[model samples]
Target: MKIYITSLLALLFSLVLNAQNLEKYEEMPEVDGVYITQNMFELLSKIDVESDDPEEQNFVELIKNLKGIKVLTTTNVEVGSQMKTDVNSYVSSENLSELMRVKKEGKFLKFYSKPGSTDQKVSQLFMFMIDEDTSEKRFVVLSIIGDIDLSEIGQMAGELKGVPGAEELKNIKDEK
Candidate 1:
């Protein structure tokens, strides 16, 4: 009986571990020419909102309620000197621990974050990108944090796919 109980406990532990992993497997959202498909969103989907970390849970709630998402594209290979200047200021001022960050590569900027007390836990990580190329430069992808309505995101995602700037924003997809 003790051995059986131990096995059951081990199984439960594993299940919890897996559940804590990213869950919502939705395609990144792209709005107009804004590129916001950051890999962080994928991981954010896995987090359970009821964790001991209030901050983490708060983020989870936010992601679940994200109304829309955006994506952008650019032709430049590097973050332009002027653009870099602007981004440096923004990234520096924004305070969010980045689980994954890629910037200054082929005119793209991806960001994800959950606003929470660092001492507690990170809740939501919004992922998006910026295209610093052509005449128009902007950070297009943005996922609203906290209790994201999947239906809203879906509806918004579908609409944005057809917009003009939508074509410029690159959509980086994940492989199963």
Candidate 2:
């Protein structure tokens, strides 16, 4: 009986891990507006720059450690709604902690992260956001994975404010 119980527990644990696997996203068919594993960021980071701004240099240093990124976006009403539901369900089932949530002007942003070697570091950062502008509604799911420095997230956030939902990155920066 004890052996059976142990086996059942192990099976359940494995199932949970599989359910949280982000690799599945990579296999998903790219929707009209959704993108996956784009190299744009890496290419942009490599530009030869002669600027003396410490902030600019700092931004470059932050991206140096980012190994992989995935992003999906949709403007379709049905798809956007479904994506939000799917992401929320996945995040909860995976037990990723909610680092921050911001709502403004009918837009919603949420940030989540999975811990790394130490409490101060994160191996993955995930974001889900819904934006309602005058023209249309946009839903986005973004995941960043690598050896992330918790302290530098704020600087990275500053550089990424132009991107949707990236502004929320500042809230969890420096948190252990």
The lDDT of model 2 is 0.72
| Weakest ten-residue segment in model 1 by summed lDDT | 22-31
TM-score of each: 0.30, 0.69
**Model 1 per-residue lDDT tens digits across residues 1-176:** 99999999997886564433211112223212433333555567676556687555545554544433432323343433333343344444455444345555344545444454342223343444555544665443343443333323333344457543323222321100
Angstrom error of the Cα, residue 123, model 2: value is 1.0
Q: Give the TM-score of candidate 1.
A: 0.30
lDDT of each: 0.42, 0.72
Q: How close is candidate 2 to the true structure, as a TM-score?
A: 0.69
Model 2: clashing residue pairs? none
Q: What is the per-residue lDDT of model 2 for residues 1-176, given as tens digits with 9 covering 90 to 100?
A: 99999999998987776565544544545433344332665776788669998877766765766767767776777767767767877787767787778788888888888888677778888888888854788878887777677667766766675776666676567455
Predicted structure 1: lDDT: 0.42
